[model samples]
Target: MNARDPSLPLQADELSGLADFAASAWDEEIVPALTDYIAIPAKSPMFDADWAKHGYIDRVTRDAAAWVESKKVAGLKLEVIRVEGRTPVIFFEVPATKSGSTDTICLYGHLDKQPEFSGWRSDLGPWTPKYENGLLYGRGGADDGYAVYAAITAILALDKQGIPRPRCVGIIESCEESGSSDLPIYIDMLRERLGNVSLVVCLDSGAGNYDQLWLTTSLRGMVSGVLKVEVLTEGIHSGDASGLVPSSFRILRQVLDRLEDSKTGRLLPDSFHCEVPAARVAQARATAAILQDEVWKRYPWSCGADGAFTLPTTTDPVEGLLNRTWRPTLSVTGVEGFPDLGNAGNVLRPYTAFKLSLRLPPLIDGNEASLKLKTLLEDNAPYNAKVTFVPDGRAGALGATGWNTPELSPWLDQALNEASNAHFGAPLGYIGQGGTIPLMSMLQKGFPKAQMMVCGVLGPKSNAHGPNEFLHVPYGKRLTAAVAQVMAAHP
Candidate 1:
């Protein structure tokens, strides 16, 4: 982790100490500790019904708190806060050394991880941390067991260099993977202790690439639910029903066809679509130019699937980038009401079920979209077959709401460019991510004056929430340095 090559853009003492501290911490403390953390199976409450009973969540929180204590920075008070019937939060507060400074900046992340996904490379497992070829492979390394580690390391780097930092509070929660259900409660409960925040840094976001500093200007929200289609009450022989009855599966397919184009993949309903902001479109073009083929090349494209499964809009990578980040899209994330192929029989199924996940534009309302989806799916049933649309939660199952990112402060822009140019010989780049970070909206409402900065190491093929997920080691170290630079200059 400490390999220093001439290629680094370590042009300043602040950046240098930041990189060095990250390397030292990773080698001496973070890797070993994170490896143990990955082994704990700290799945979010949604995925693991027995999360509290299993105690894995609490175990990881304690481990994280212990690591912060080992840093031993002055005025560092680390607490594992447990509220009733909710996941715990690792709340660490550090007073700024800059005299008379009351500026409080919040750094947000989550230790709670997604469930172990299938299709990991042969040599890797979700619980087994493996380091090779400059990547750390394991769940939570990128999304986001590294946030607390990186946040702490950034502050300590400033400490080592005698640089003044604004008052900083790190809120590493245990419920982000569950759509941050418990985070708002804690944010409200601790509003007084949290004080006022001028700046909020969120590390639970995606970078455009690994070569330079990337900032998340906005995040896309989502609407999700299950659509069920039932034609008959009991299974029947397929041969007897083939010509006489409409297949429930076929009817379900037709319903989906109403929402999205089967060929072009464009969303069908006008209500599900929103006008993309011109500013964001311009940013996408700029980032698309910088990334070029990398926008398409980074996917594993297993077995050369890119050739066969490429999107129709692949001709213009810029459009694809916009499509991913700014445009509304739909995905059938899961399905049920059918037996596994291995256990399949000749009987016709009585019903078909599909779990839908729809990604909305950055400015769209998730509740409105959910209502549209439910109406579109259940309004007119084909052949009078029963159709049902059930939301996984209240109307907006994901509490989905996108944010129009405020303009960047001049100081933050300078810090981003300096860090980027120093480390990678490149300028800073900004892009909107397709993923949702609920805290972004909450913080905007909670502290209307705070400028939010979202950055992370989850570049393409870093594969967060997927099998073989990894944290790019070099990017992580450089990003830690970049964040330190931001903190050092926040005042």
Candidate 2:
């Protein structure tokens, strides 16, 4: 419907008051629900085939919506939208209080979590949420379970002070980790109800650090699938067929060689890369300068006997950052048909599978990239063997267009900076995150004119998608305050 403005601008005193409310809500409400959420193990559709059958995702969506409804905010409309077969989306709206306004703001997040990874320090586990030293260690907390709370906290915080804001609609789905395959369905079904969103806030992204607000300028696309190769009909004894069998693993390596160089660790084909935008390169250099040693130290580098491998021989952090964020890279994330060391035997295998995950530059095309990958790996197979590369996420293809920076209004920018400086004594940090958020491209296409403000608590040492992943408690509180401040100042 119509919207009215809050006091037009958020002041220093308002920020302090917002922070106080945020801290209290975080301690009394957010933490408890998030802890319970972590324990559920609501894995994405991609990771958990039984997600629908198990019903954990549905529980997460409904429980989360009910919790928000439990808050009893004024004019709040909440519901758990579920298609017959697709995953659920927690859809809700907070009607605008002010008059003569039609601007709608869409806030987004997801409930799905990545699978539990290895290596947890202290008494930590993926499903067991532990609060220690201002950090909540668990999966999905920072990578994004906090978004709905943050967005609602902002709205409620503003509402508590009688500050009016634009009508806010939120959609937190259960399929983000699975390339957001189900999200577009929700978007399409609710397109008319969503209205013309003037601004969008995504709290599922990366940050340089916890010192201040960080805005993601661009996101690299991703192409992932399983590459399987088969040779003989069955496993053969090494003594009987070692020489003549031509190991299947060797053939798999040959297929990979067509895509990447095993020696220098570079993508071999030119089809996978694109020229980095000059401004992005400059931004990378600036971000590198700001982060300094943090650019490399953020990673958990190993120190083995002969000294751990050097970080790919970059002359400076800027080159390393650009190479990582704006360049296409290939990583073999998983493998099959190989036994563990203790279970190993002197035997040749019939087939081998390498799980392929390739990151694409912002300007590259994922559809074209996947086609090239399938062609390179499957065509002209070593011995005309059965090999397949399947893109297993959404639309029969795990492809996403890279998102460019959206234009931000001056008022919005001012709100973000003021919020950052007030909540965190440091200025806002602007950087490009290397990870993929499956919905960025879709949202940009749908809301072509909306100003996208991507912020999150996934800072250094948060270890998202890895072991010991955590949510910085204080940072989340402040992030909520920031969102509130932005909401208060929305045009």
Candidate 3:
């Protein structure tokens, strides 16, 4: 598009120029835009059923699409694609600079966010943007509202330095936090348009540390739903029902016991897990050696009365990494059927409901796992209490599937190390993330041979999806430059 010579390789000085360009863009444009973005409550459709009426999702999507167009990158075409009754996606493309090159690079990110979680520091609410000590703190900033902005910055950085890159396309969706339910529709519509993808740069992932570029080698799948157990039609006086009624809370616990081991925190179903690939286990061991005890120590632990901090389930770094990345786990995220503590009374609750979230290994099918989970929790109710387990997502698409990246090509492997050394002065790191990115699996299947550059700014203590989440701005800048370098090296 720039009419620049594509044969010339990026020199050391040019890489520096790319970094400087990315830094300037982040400071002057991207940061301010993300600050405004963080202030919007663009909750995903799953979290906000009235998302269309709320207009937050539309607002952010519109704003991001406008920003891309305003860049005025030569030969770049942008569009906000929409299907009836579905969330929007921002699709854009730039013609390849390399003459006769048909390879395409797909850049992916999402704009919607998790619901505002409690427990933020008094000064740092999810909707309030605060920039301090090179970190931008907010709800979606790290988990990845910064991705779309960073992706563009990477492309622009290459153009600014006259570095010829492969044809590039961007797909920024607004439904990722909701298991990317609407993305498949858009993908089907845009299949022919997204031609011959060879490299995928996904910014919706995590890092082992901020020192180097972290490539997410794999991701865990997820299945979430509400499990409810009801024993009575209405609440009754505790004095009258204590001895006569079987407690719904107790019955709920019994049902959960069927799924998880309380003491070890392991899922009981063998089908819910898969044997970790030997290659992944080897990578985990190498990553564990690099991270050491920080794997478990990075978490914010509470202190006990004796002045000692709470211990993690395991202190061994290898086990810690494997437990989180390769093992199936269950979490009770939310609960209902209880009154406020301040309004405590002598009443026995009629029913108890828990929002259950299950994380599955990468190879497992999420839909299959969700069905198995439902049967395990709902079959033969304890105390004959009415029980139901309704999995989230559309009927056939009841869970978010995980992805295991395809093996890196020889050139890509060298380029990753080269880019990391150029920008961060460190070699690239490989690690499996515990979170799910639904689009990755779809893209992997859609383009079976695409080399994935799944990296992001969500590093240690970023706390994505939790309170006080923040984006490490410095890391974001370096990652942008690194992406440019890799795109330039595509062969």
Candidate 4:
């Protein structure tokens, strides 16, 4: 049997000690630690000019590293690792117990957050952490801040029970919210320092609901660019330009109309290629069976009591879920040419630009998609307008398949099932998240043979990256217990 297999069985006393440790450590300590962590406003570099100057990121990283070190688990040493021009990654490890008996397991998470957008309800702020109605509220509470606490709590609980831990390394990066631009450089620098790892546990993703354990089977890649259209050299009176010259705004709208079907919110011109994988469709069907009602209820608007969208026929809940997670989607995130209230005028603006963010399917090639999109936009320019497509960012999707570790899956499933049953009074379902985790792809490339398991606590309506983002405290505690159970099961 492999070291992480819980089926091997723990002695009665060991199990009892673990249960007790989980109750004290997680209930009293870890939850509070997460609360404190959520208070830091370590927005991603794109969102903040003072990410380094404010020192919030550095402060939080050091605080987390110190907390891990204070645990003092036997054979475990904690340290902060930094590479020039990149954010610091907090690294800690519990050394292997005996030759050929223990294998290293890596845990990954991030500490950065997206800028808080407007439209929040009263009593919510970007940085201030709040707790209300069983949820812990803040920006980074769910997206990633909780992972470091969860990793430490799980390992420490095992140590308290005197169980030998598999050699484990916990890596917490600080810039994921900015698309993890610095990750590649940091990985190259630590390539030699980080040795062979058998399995990786990424604790930064979403759950289908409070009752389910979600695994991201595939992630859609993303490409973002700005589409600019220019007609006149300078602004002109609308009265003069109306009949003589085409309005730049009207022309810009015409160009965009060809790219998407506004009435249906679907992409047009057939530029994107996305086919839902058979496995992903099947998984979504299974998830929909249990979560359909909850999913509908979470939406701000409901279609009567059924909450179904208007289609010719009834839409399958599974298909709706699949569309978001596995298919390609495009959205115009921002417009640069439009003026605010005070700048209102009757003159036709000479230039207009809009930011387009496209989410590509797992099988789609990011570069190819970017090039095709650019060609389409340039070729379709109206009135012989000066059109330009400036690439912003691109990341290819990562597919999670194969490399199933003999030691991890069964234990994780069992522990998660037991915890879900106890907390939500139901069986936990597995689902895939639509969001991207660039680190997972990086790790897979570095450790080609490593088995990977991705799971986390965010659920529907958690509003991660949106206002009023929160971490459910009760759910988080239960998740911590589940992690402890997995550790006890691990050899």
Best by TM-score: 3
User: What are the lDDT scores of the predictions, listed in order?
Assistant: 0.83, 0.84, 0.92, 0.70
lDDT by residue for model 1 (1-491), tens: 11232223344664666778878877777767777887779999878989989999999998889989998988898888888899999888998766667889899989999999899999999999998988889999899998998899888887776677778998999988777778877888888888789999999988888889999988888876789999989989999998688899999999989999988788988876678878888888898888888887777663544556443457587887888877888888788889998989998899999988788887887767778888899988999999998765431244477776888779778878887887667899988888988788889988998988899989988999899999888888888888887776675
By TM-score, the candidates rank as 3, 2, 1, 4
Best by lDDT: 3
How far residue 58's Cα lies from its native spot in candidate 3, in Å, is: 0.4
Q: What TM-score, over all chains together, does every model reach?
A: 0.93, 0.96, 0.98, 0.86
> Number of clashes in every candidate structure?
1, 2, 0, 2
| TM-score: the better of candidates 3 and 4 | 3
After superposition, candidate 2 runs with Cα above 4 Å error: 1-8, 307-315
| Model 2: per-residue Cα lDDT over 1-491, one tens digit each | 22324555656676788999999999999999898988889999888899999998988888889888988988888878889878999989888866656999899999999999889876889999898999999999887998898788888887887767788999999898878878888889899989879888999988898888888888888888999998878788889998887778888888888988788678888877788778777878778878987887788777768897456446478877877778778888889889999988978888899888898887677777878788888998887778889886675555765677776679877888888898998777778777888677888889898888888999888999999999999999988988888876776
Clash pairs, candidate 3, are none
RMSD of each: 4.3, 1.9, 1.1, 4.3
Better of 2 and 3 by TM-score: 3
Report residue 133 deviation for candidate 2 (angstroms): 0.3
Give the residue spans of candidate 1 off by over 4 A.
1-11, 302-312, 394-398
